[model samples]
Target: MNDIVDLFVIGGGVNGTGIARDAAGRGLGVTLAELGDLAQATSSASSKLIHGGLRYLEFYEFRLVRESLQEREKLLAAMPHIAWPMRFVLPHHSGLRPDWMLRSGLFLYDRLGGRGLPGTKRINLRSHPAGALLKPSFRTGFEYSDAWVDDARLVVLNARDAEMRGATILTRAKVVSTTRHAAHWDVEVERDGRIHTHRARKLVNAAGPWAGKLSETTGDPHRLRLVRGSHIVLPRLPGHDQPYILQGGDGRIVFVIPYEDDFTLVGTTEAEHHGSASEAVCSPEEKAYLVDFVNDYFAHPISTDDIVWTYSGVRPLIESEGSARSASRDYQLAYDDDGAPLLTVLGGKLTTFRKLAESALERLGYGGQWTARAPLPGGTFDRRQGVAMIGRWMEAHPFLTEAWARRLLRSYGTEAETILGNAATAEDLGQDFGATLSEAEVRFLMRHEYARTAEDVVWRRTKLGLRLDAGQVAALDAFMAEARGEAAAAE
Candidate 1:
């Protein structure tokens, strides 16, 4: 901890981890410290789309949209397991923007970034399968290609890849203080009731919502506007697999997408958040807003009673002269080299994390942008081989149900084989905590993925929390606790 490293990153969200991975791959000695678990905040609370920010076109953020669209293709190719192409159906509403406007936007979107996926096309609501559950007034819709991602897992995988390339990832570690020296930084980190000081040539303040507060310690005079975005999950709407992009009357848009296998994920509302970012939650008002937003289009209206789960995250946007909904989604990297170098990341979305990382390093006087081609851990195979990989898993282990096999392939990719090992039967994989969550898989996550608690395993590492009942979750908690105790005793 006393040795000076090349970089010290203060955050474990998408941007922080992406920077660590990219820097480590370029032969920089990097260390990343997270106040809590990885993706414990805004990074995990995204709408889970890797699109080019189609709505931003109206805001005239062409540069951000173009970079994001380009990054979307690279990210999907890099992590085929956790990210994939998803088509979004935007229903035409006569009361809102005109059809020609929508067409023009989609046309620009299709050509803005390099074409890795299918382009936009018009569809008849009465004939398209995605429109079956919609209200009768919608006669036309536009379908465009974007990508879906396991947001939380994406953060964890970046941390994993960073560690694989020689970056030190510290979780449950909080930076209590930082002192700038002539040539290096002295960062005091508190973990496990002990304080450790690490010296680094440069520091990166990538803390999402907390970045503004952290910047105050260094006298960085940048202000951030905290915007809270919330989402709600419900039982899957019984019709199609494609997601919907609903245009709200407030000039904002919401997404209702298929989540996990049995639920629908609808989001999100932009409200000015006051107070602590960690305290942000899906308020009753926000929940009502979302339920009403979707009810406007769905033929079978849904009430708040249908909601199964809710989550919210606070976004730290650079102070702008507009409403929260109109604030920019693009990022700004401010590098201050007064004493020791400090790069503060402000206002970024999930789709552009990789690009943000490359830019961050270049600002720090480092080069070699190699993350675009490097695959994340277990994502070494081509994206087209995903189905073949699943088939191989099922063929190798007949005990695995088709659903279970597909889940494993999607979650871990090539690493799924390592978890299976030589187990010929489901019983060999150890205790089944229901919903196909096996003890072997749980241990693998704890051993390799830095999973410390059942919440980390179920909620962040995987969305199996939606399937596991309270009792099953309790059992998982007890098991993980006992396992940790045994590990400590062994040490």
Candidate 2:
């Protein structure tokens, strides 16, 4: 925190980390400060889809869709472990738009990225295996492509890659204030009750929902619209593998995607978020609404008791007059001049952070002057490389359980082995913190993933929160308390 950095970034969500990664890859001396654990805010609470916001097609966001579509494949190729493909099946309903209209949209979805993925196909719901979980009334459906992303890990990976490129990342360090001088910006960050100041030639506010608030810290009163989206995790349906997209009686579309190895994720009510982002949570009414919607169409019924977990996020949409669902997910970036420059990002989705970062940098005057083949840490594996690496690693470590190995592969790609490093046996994994969590893995996350607390591990670094027991959760918190103290002691 001594040397003046070329770029100082606020927020550790996907946007800030992504911009840091890109800037560092371009050889910029960058430093990023996160007030809380990385992605603990809105980033980790997302529905975790890296799609082109298929429903946005209704609002004629073709340009945004096209860019997101292009990013889908690029992201999948970059981090197959954390970002991969999933197909969403939309069942045709009598009241909704016709099949022909859906088909046309699917066709566009196919071509949006110039064939980054296969085109959509019509599904004979009754005949296809995917339809077995649906009610008898549903006979036809449309299947389209999209990628599922590990939102929090995506942010961590970007931060990791940035660190590898010499960007200093400080987690649990909140930016208390930003003051602009004639030539540079002075940032004061508070960590463990201690205040530390850093100087940067340029500052970027990539604070996700808090972007506007951070702008105020720099004395720029930018406006932002906060739209809340909530998702519920329920017991998985029997034989549910592929994801399903259901149209509500209302115009909104809901996703019932296969989640962790044991559960299913259904959700998302988009409401105008009119209050603090810190208080965002799935409301009682939204829970009932989602359950009712799912039971209406699915063969299996779900009740509130079946919901194991729930999360909500405030999407910082560019304010518009229409309903929250109709609001644009497209991002807005602005910078001020007067010698010291500050860049701000308004709205962004999990899928489009990379593209968003590129655009923000361009506006910050890095356009055309630089280019990068930058990949997130552990993302050196292209799709083909990832599989080969996973197979080879598993083969060499035959003692490792297939389930454990597979989970690690999907979570960390080739870097999974790096996390498992020299462990010779399952017992070497240390105390079983429940689920597949081991003391080794927990320590690895603390060392590599920028995790500061149990929430950082269970909620963000891993989705084990959905599986850990109450006692296990307590134990993890105990360990986290010690690790956090250790982290502070180091400084």
Candidate 3:
């Protein structure tokens, strides 16, 4: 049995953690439960972007676009470590959207959010660096500004901040059942082969694709349409630092972004997903579709064989009459106060998560909105200081490599020193499990970041999974398990 909390969050994704962080910061007791590792599902498998959906303008989603654009700068400022600005080049295809339409859309996008980022401009592809990599047919293009993010890290940071603000975070804790009463709700959470009971004054369903199924238990009539968005990673396409937004004839768009320095990330295909959301994988068709889509734009065509990695996430969108690509990225907060207040988050995107959290709290009648101005964990410094911070790290620790220092800065920002701590040489960081993943860093992640498994460390906490091989991953997993066992035995 546990003390009755003010809010019980069911899920550990972006939305759930965001709500927990917001509520906890406002002096509300919060407990968040996740069935798996934090960001093990949809949250970690995103296209890794924090941008207003440029294509949403085509569907006349003015409100969604406006909200997302407004949030873009705020989010970037909040977490400069994990989120930073990126320039996107959209090649003007004669057969697709016309020049005037693109210009008009870009114009609206630039002004919609008060123009914090650089505005759009027309560029001659033949003379531009990005154009050198593109097909000759793309003589001209439009460049606009957006941002990139480490999607999984964003969720973990929110959870970390929430925990710091007095919220209880339970990873691998499954909410087995929930019983609502007139004043509170009784929730049963199963973890470590045992079931724990908790009581809360309010319940939140931020389970992403699983929200629909969880709604049945709360007796809420809301449903969600599961749409799978998949992405493929290929070896880095040279000659361009800016990412390209390739327009497709099928009214879809694919992003070819530089990823992890040595690789390129191209995605994502929108397809209606069925069955279990957890089982969603990048299918052969999705891979082929992405390959074919990029081939149309790149001067050097790539086959599916060039794909080094693929990931898929099932997005729980609002049930509407349209194709999955045309579905709304806008979120709806369904507040059911028949008994205990139940707030169900329906649909949302990465860019507007903070706004969504504000809305969720507002629905629950909690006021003091503070996340917009506050920085997340490890993000207390100015956004523009990232590069200087990394340089300082290298200057202070002359033994550290530029790549290692840069990775640490990007992952931990000002807190990287906490891990580096008094180490005069790289050997002081202890065992290296390949890909610059030192034991010191691993311990920090496990102790502070709620990282239990290597999957959580490599894939979610940092993208070292792209660099580590199978044997190295296995070794890392073994090391983590052994470390956990030793800690448990000691306890």
Candidate maximizing lDDT: 1
TM-score of each: 0.99, 0.96, 0.99
Q: In model 3, which regions exceed 4 Å deviation?
A: none
Tens-digit per-residue lDDT, 59-100, candidate 1? 999999999999998998899889989989999999999999
User: What are the per-model C-alpha RMSD values against the true structure?
Assistant: 1.0, 1.8, 0.9
Cα lDDT, all candidates = 0.93, 0.84, 0.92
Q: Would you list the rank order by lDDT, best first?
A: 1, 3, 2
Looking at model 2, which ten-residue stretch has the lowest summed lDDT?
367-376
* Local distance difference test, candidate 3: 0.92
Error of 2 at 467 (Å): 1.7
lDDT of candidate 3 over 1-491, digit per residue (tens): 99999999999999999999999999999999999999999999888888888899999999999889889889988898888899999999999999999999989889886768889999999998889988899999899999999999999999999999999999999999999999999999999899999999999999999999999988996889999999999989877588999899999999999998889999899999987999999999999999999989889989999888999999999999989889999899999999999999999998889999999999899999898858988999997787788888888888888888888988898889999998888899998999889999999999899998989999999999999999999998999999999988999
lDDT winner between 2 and 3, please give it: 3
In model 1, which runs have C-alpha deviations exceeding 4 angstroms?
A: none
Candidate 3 scores a C-alpha RMSD against the true structure in Å of 0.9
